[model samples]
Target: MKEFTFTITDPQGIHARPAGLLVKEAKKYAATLTILKGTKKGDLKKIFTVMGLGVKQGETVTVQAQGADEDAAAAAMEAFLKENF
Candidate 1:
């Protein structure tokens, strides 16, 4: 398993647009991707669960990938967050 933590920088937070994009990106990987905010966890491949978190600006979230391509998946998720969030 591989994981990384990121603090949201976007003023708008992880709203609908980015959440949809994030889910799309997550589907590209075979690994199981999960985003955790506090005690709440969401499947990265599912947009509703992600948006359900209501991740706001300045909040920290941890992303975990566990599967055959965990390394690449985790790296991609980190880069995606940095580039888009």
Candidate 2:
């Protein structure tokens, strides 16, 4: 498993578009991807699950990936957050 924490820097936070993008990216990997906000964690491949977390700007969330391509999943997610959020 691979994991890293990142702050939501986008002013709008993890809204529909970003969450959709996240789900899309997550789908590209064979690993299971999840996002943790506080004590709540949800599957990254599902948009509804991610949106249900109600993550807001400035919140620190943990991105976790577990499976054969965990490292790649983590790196891709980290890059997305850096470039998009």
Best by the TM-score measure: 1
In model 1, how large is the Cα lDDT of residue 30?
97
Estimate the TM-score for candidate 1.
0.98
- Candidate 2 achieves a global lDDT of 0.92
The local distance difference test score of each candidate is 0.96, 0.92
Give the clashing residue pairs of candidate 2, or none.
none
Error of 2 at 73 (Å): 0.7
Residue 60 of model 2, lDDT score: 92
lDDT digits (tens) for residues 1-32 of candidate 1: 89899999999999999999999999999999
